[model samples]
Target: MTRLWIPFITLLSSALFTNAAQASADPLVTIQKKWAQCQYQRSQEKQQIYCFEQLIKRNQQALNSAPTRADLKVWLAINKSSLAGAQGGIGALSLVEEAKDLLEQVIDQAPETLDGSAYTSLGSLYYKVPGWPVGFGDDDKAEHMLKKALAINPNGIDPNYFYGDFLAEDGRKKEAIQYLTRAQKAPPRAERPLADQGRQQEIAAKLKELQ
Candidate 1:
């Protein structure tokens, strides 16, 4: 799916880099942090689009350097998805399709990468996009992927939040509230204060609507 349904997501590495050198040393971590900034901190539509495009390019270069790196591929897909969300239109579908392919690659190579982030992201896409004839949206596949993510990271904020959101969207408010509540109580990420805060606000908003 695009950004509007479920915004671009990146899981923060547990280790927090203290300096620019440390940040640059890990291209994946750097891109993830930048993604949070672009997704949550930026407000201007044009700027957000530019930011996502730049990240996508940078991520693609990283992937080129390390073709076998599933993590890099995952981030590249996320940036592409974000860009698709920002520049919505008939054209956006192509970007998301590209993202879907990248994510699928990650799953095939490393389903356990980033605590099953590929599953969470892929599941979100399945539900957010339109159904066949128009898009490839499928509720059953979405549930399957989301559940796989949940099984991998039971207490993860992203998985729970996303599963809850999926359930809510499907008109299952009671179950959605339960997962959302667990997501709200998930531990904070020392490396991602901004993302944690932004996500919490989103969870709160979702709960408010469901309740």
Candidate 2:
């Protein structure tokens, strides 16, 4: 299973917190900053696994301190998801299972704190993992999770774009075109260029295929 990891930025929107400079620092914010740093490290392709593990450690500490903060829980889950990808790269199935358990906990707690972000993550997990007789990917589970995400936030770019990718990979050409088109038309984000361009290309290609 080749995991498609979503960037942490989408899961932790600036608007979700008050102005960072003006707001007093909390354990949640501190952990979030660490997680953001880890994401930056991953992007730079430097010590990806170690950086993510550091993020997990920080988030775990924060969660222990303030276990009720839904945001921290979700962020922890997101970090675990990234860690699973890192583990997969190294052929570590055991680590992937550990990460999956963390994600499930996040979903069980609050699926709405991150604007249906958890569902998008889980959907990608199911979509990317290789299925039974071979591995763990389950398209049915992927579709269910993606649909739940869409229901929670119909106009969300991440779900639309990723779900489009899932549909395309599953040979549902028309549905894929629809979702990719929706993603391309999504509200602009200053920090999500890759997601924006990827959806645009997906839409264009699927549109061509249908025609």
- The segments of candidate 2 whose C-alpha lies over 4 angstroms from its true place after superposition are 1-15, 18-46, 133-135, 189-211
Against the hidden reference, what TM-scores do the models get? 0.91, 0.72
1-211 in candidate 2: lDDT tens per residue? 2444333233433234456564446655565555555655355544777888887888788789887776776667667766666555435444545545666777787777667777877777777765665456688898998898888878877788778878877878788878878876878655444435544555576567755
Best by lDDT: 1
Least lDDT summed over 10 consecutive residues: which range in candidate 1?
A: 1-10
Candidate 1, residue 78: Cα displacement in angstroms equals 1.0
TM-score of candidate 2 against the unseen true structure: 0.72
Q: For model 1, which pairs clash?
A: 1-125
Kindly provide the TM-score of model 1 when superposed on the true structure, using C-alpha atoms.
Answer: 0.91
Candidate lDDT (C-alpha), each: 0.83, 0.66
Per-residue accuracy of model 1 over 1-211 as CA lDDT, tens digit each:
2324445564433334588788679888778788998999789989999988888888889889999888788778878888877887667889889989998998998998888889988988888777788778889999999999999999999999989988998889899999999999999987778889888999999999988
Per-candidate total of colliding backbone pairs? 1, 3
List clashing residue pairs in candidate 2.
129-137, 130-136, 130-137
RMSD of each: 2.7, 4.4
